[model samples]
Target: MKKVCWPYFDPEFDSLSERIYGPTCRVCIDNESLEDCTVVKVDSLNKQGLLLEVVQVLTDMNLIISKGYISSDAGWFMDVFHVKDADGNKLADQRVINYIQQAIGTTRDPPKPKAYTTGKPLEPEPHSERTTIEMTGTDRPGLFSEISAALADLHCNVVEAHAWSHNARLACVAYISDQSTDTPIEDHHRLAAIEDRLTTVLRATTSSATAGGNCTNQQQREAKSGGGGGTMTNVERRLHQLMLSVRDFDRPLAMMEVASEEGGKASVLIESCREKGYSIVTVQCRDRPRLMFDTVCTLTDMQYVIFHASVDSHDGYAFQEYFIRHVDGCALNTEGEKERVVKCLEAAIERRVCEGVRLELSAKQRVGLLSDITRVLRENGLAVVRADVATHGGKAVNAFYVRDISGNDVDMEFVESMRREMGPIDLAVRNEKSLMPPNTADHQRPRFSISDILKSKIERFSHNFVAIK
Candidate 1:
């Protein structure tokens, strides 16, 4: 047959083998075994959610899959996946099957679109005729309300308003309409009056009046220093402090040297702070070490310093004099730094309460459930005392302790509304006496009187101690 070439039997058979396998499906090649490959169909409407759920389930099952595809009509999704056990066999597991079923069940129908007519006249812009006042400064609380109230007092209509803050600063945009612009009150004069009022209010409301005044004066000085471009005024400072207290992530550091018996209590505090998302710089344990005040001052980045003598009388007056002497630019004198530190600590405390609430409800099936409870609390203007989430038997168990939860002065209807929003949450009123225990020997120390110290000092210095609950 004229020396017929038999490629199968020839030495060049390797080239033929490569050609045969070159066009193999990516799904089949990646899995390396045909038996490992699985093709599953999912509902197209909820494909994204189903895919995410399936991916999470697969990750848990130690399975690997390649790219997926959607079919025509957008009603079906096809996923090619495989599982690798210790033995390397690619087979679907019970978990994968359950996940697929769950995904299918959870698939939702696509939302229907509403028809809209064209060629209709657009609605006129709201508040176009109103006088707009643009206020810019470091973000803080009550600024918007105060501005609105001031406008109201001036017989001005607050047509539109919005407030935003960043890095301990606030800016507000408000539109006001006055009956007559020809009156003695011009926009600039009105703004100046409002600014003055805000400064007075900030100084009055602050726990540290001197510090508040100093901060206001600093802003004024800065404005004047810049040749009157006008820095953030008093209202802005208050608003900024409030915003920082509520949102900033920086936390005060708490350092302690506890015995092995007290270690557990300290751990609880550390865990509480962690739950609240406050950063813990350090936790040390030692027996009768030298009083190192600078270490705390350096590590904590605290402008104000305070030291509490341990419960054991043996560790007395550890580094108090050193701290008073060495630490310069103390918050006691620097008003801005004091307020910033106070606001930071307040944020930390709030974070702790939030964490406690979350820990108490850790057994809940969904995080959204807890979020709903918090939303309700915020809507009703109720202060959350403590929230804890704990898990038992693979289910989230939650407990909410709130202040003024009895609904005496608050509307019962609103309380019921909040209860409804919580959706089967275990809400409870906090017992104040139980939460705050009586002072022990540690509380009676002759060191710096925490209560006697000015609120500014306490607020500034408290950042060094981490709150557990």
Candidate 2:
């Protein structure tokens, strides 16, 4: 074995480390530096997973990252981002700027684990009226129907939810409350029963056509209640982590062939840098919000350390490059390993590109609301590819990206009829031209803001549904 000298052995390394990791953190915003977008410059320590953390914060705020330049190969981390709000305007709100600064600067110290002298963690305070359920299982048609039906049967009202499926694996997080009381269910037995019911529904498989093969493996059928087992901060990010944990990247041979055939314009290329002891991965695809966050989250969860990276978007296309290595400090040494990395990165990028029409719904909160909505979709031969469910005040504001059961484009005529049947005032279809595949051309992405949708729903909530808090 060859011996490698450690960089920290030099005494000067200590001073440099202290200076970079000092208590003071800086996040500068310069609107004058860019003609089209606001520029955000960050100088902080190169902490593990720091890149993903920053990207995640901006993404969750619904900010669009037009371009990014990252350099964190050493102790210091420095980066610049060109960002715009959802409406394609530079960030102008002082409150928003202050929030970004605080969020980026306050991550130096990770939250400490609770004291566990008795070998058990302290139970967190119960969420006032919402209980979140996290589940992972086989991906199949009508799976969401079954899960929502089960919850409805148990007298639970779905408040908010998100689900993702890829490579024949499904993961979902749902927030629910007592249907009658509108409060969180604290009974241990009831919670366990809910878990059992949902687990059974997820484990039931009707065919072998599921993309990755039969899902009889015990690891796939899992259901946990109590607010994602007490650590569910970001539902979408948790979905990524759950999918990675189950190795959803390992697609079946037939599925891989189909994906390759339908690869569209997205491409991933891996190149070796033997001289530098690093492997470079480049991804090219249509530009959209949260593109950088998705790739960075996948890399961090896969145990690959990104030493340096660059991101840019132009003419409706995105280009991202990463210099990465295994956490073991070794470059990819085999073709098989490289291929796996490529497949995983591709999966990460595609998982968020929902393939279907976008439907936005707003209604008064009530029991069996979710079940009824999903049942209608199932009856109309529509399958949900992505869903975001949320509630505010006393209204449910949700979005569903769906396709036909046969995996074809939905008929707009039929969708219009369905909307009419379901009350056109409550259910509306937005312009999803921007959500098209990367190969699509000449379609300008639309500006759809979740906050704006929520506000509109809340404003229209006649006195009947308003709750005086």
Candidate 3:
């Protein structure tokens, strides 16, 4: 009859023990319940040949196996397996013991870490090493694309990125890697240059001449509304209309409308924009109402236009007559516009899903509260988008739109841990319509990677053997 074995180090015992020892004994001595253990070992001719060798041994022994894990630490390679022996015993065997000894003897020495040199450029790895670049400043459009283009020019690949805009400012983090290693020092120098270029780009993009031009018209309207106290309601109505128009557009666009006489109205517009996936820009109209258009321009590749109009009582029957004109033509939509919009929306939704936390702070029940939840979500690698905060009877209620979570990636244990950390919170995980699994109708044989199969088998044996103990 065939059997399975595992070799694991026990620091406390100062020796290697049969993870599965005797045919009718506990594999893990600490666990008394397990019994009927058996150990087996296999030999590999080459260090890299361990995977194939283990497969052959298992086949020869007629053992059934599943999952496994391999770890290398402290000058030793450890392979843990889960399997069942032949004779339908579902127990460990001696073959596992021999395999463990062979694996250890044949294990290769760990590779030495390479040092970065100044004169001689290092050879680039097949896969680029990931690094992050962070930018913070007054928010402006086109910032994202300008930085992306600069990285691209430097032969740097952007693997992942994130940007957030709030209170008239923006911050972003981009994961990038350099593809060329002809000169490592030169590549580092290029990164520095890119940083400098980024600063310049931000300055140019956020300048008053470029972004300021779009809000001139709104500023004038606000000034006029303030001058005519009776027209406050009319001005608010018009601003709301503009916001609705922008939101209703096929593409996402941020909107900011300011009127000095009706500051509350401006706040309402800003809140509405946030719900619609648009970054709210602050409008400060001291003399003439001015809207500061500051969003990641490159990501959206859009331009801003300011339209100013003066309405006279005689020109309009009962309301003021206003003139409308574009300050500048911003790029509207480009190639791949639909796909980009969908991706942005999907990302936004995922951020909301991952960032959501249950909150119970008051007598009344609340769904989502983001104040402390946002930080927690960020720590757990979640991005938040739309956050709704409401209060009923002195209790806070909150809901959020998030990015980067799906059922496939959800870990139940992690979710439970999060629940324990956050006091009395409810979680609503959203299903993404765009992410559907492929159909596997055909009964094609599942091709397993040699290493993967070996690992699986070892895990099966280890788990069963431990259970017996």
Candidate 4:
């Protein structure tokens, strides 16, 4: 029988007594009873980062909940969300409901009886020449992720490829095959969908300069007519646009898989650990879509505060070093906890779906890229708080502080998932903490680093180092 198993930490996780292998409580999204809001009820055995996972799922689904109630006791949790879809309408999609169920560690599909079989491996499917996925777009951080994600959504499995960038332009060509059939993609509609998704992402990559103008006339008409959903005045809209340029987003992370030529594996080493203190986490993994984001997200979900991060990617692997402490300012001393973290990170980086705030890109300084990024955020039920855009040797390095349109922090467990969790309620704070220093007991200012000094000098010397558009 083919068997699947969740990553296990120790005897407890592997034991039936722990209920990790027991019948899981069914997860459900109850919408029929509510008129204005959907009720998402999740009942499951509690696990680390379980709460944040729920939030991430809800946020990714573009659901807005006016209120929520949570109760947990004796290794079990029951969370309810009074929610509505991104369009401010009732949530009724069975597919979405099923997704939520599966995401929260519950399943509605009837369990298939185990199949008896010989232990011999099945014969492999025939191989073929690969369909190629090629991309030429703005070069920036997380750029590869956008391309890889588009391919993944089309169910195209990467076989091999070459990717590079020069002067803010990126070119990537991937040899790929259908994941299910292990053959070259022959479906024209699927090919078109892949191309269309890639194009949209590329547009987003270089879109800061071209966004918003086309919608301005329509927005003005709507504002004057008092019929559209927005309530911002024209002046407010202009100011909002201006603010977009000055905001510096956090550095986005991406991971991509390598072809056969490059052997790939993910590994983690936790050192300098003490009870109630800090640890140094080192992760080495194959680059996959959102690898950086997933790593950071997992750390945050586990309530770790990153005090320092050093990152580098070469060939086909990524190496990341992190100085971290728990949110309560404690160190992880248990092997089980550390193992859980390592496994969680592995799962996060390998995830292929574009659920929640997953896609990020770096691009050339297109005339309206910022405007476009902002517009896309609004359209996709995402909110951008802080951003940083700079040009380096004619190429732009930009970062964004973004969250799926969930407002307010759901306690400290989700600070990383929420990006600007500690900032003011509205996205109006001048000093952003999307990437703040490790949380300090007294909240003292972080000691200066070389880049900090250089950043200050650059701002002092360049009149437009961070000037608003």
Candidate topping lDDT: 2
Candidate 1 wrong stretches, greater than 4 Å? 1-147, 164-171, 179-187, 208-469
Instruction: In angstroms, give how far residue 200 of model 1 lies from its true place.
Output: 3.1
- Candidate 2, 194: how far from true, in Å? 1.0
lDDT, candidate 4, residue 211?
Answer: 33
Candidate 1 least-lDDT 10 residues:
222-231
Enumerate clash totals for all models, in the order shown: 33, 0, 66, 28
Estimated TM-score for each candidate: 0.24, 0.81, 0.22, 0.29
Q: Output the number of the TM-score-best candidate.
A: 2
Candidate 3: TM-score?
0.22
Relative to the true structure, candidate 4 reaches a TM of 0.29
Per-residue alpha-carbon lDDT of model 3 for 434-468, expressed as tens digits? 21113323223232122232343334334212110
The residue ranges of model 2 lying beyond 4 angstroms of the native Cα positions read: 1-24, 108-129, 210-214, 228-233, 252-257, 263-265, 407-425, 434-469
Q: At residue 132, what lDDT does model 3 achieve?
A: 47
Candidate numbers sorted by lDDT from highest down: 2, 4, 1, 3
**Model 4, which residues run further than 4 Å from truth?**
1-22, 59-62, 69-74, 102-469
When summed lDDT is taken over every stretch of 10 residues in candidate 2, the lowest stretch is: 112-121
List runs of model 3 lying over 4 Å from the truth.
Answer: 1-128, 181-188, 209-469
Q: Give residue 421's error in model 2 in angstroms.
A: 7.8
Model 3 whole-model lDDT (C-alpha atoms) = 0.32
Q: In model 3, what is the error at residue 407, expressed in angstroms?
A: 34
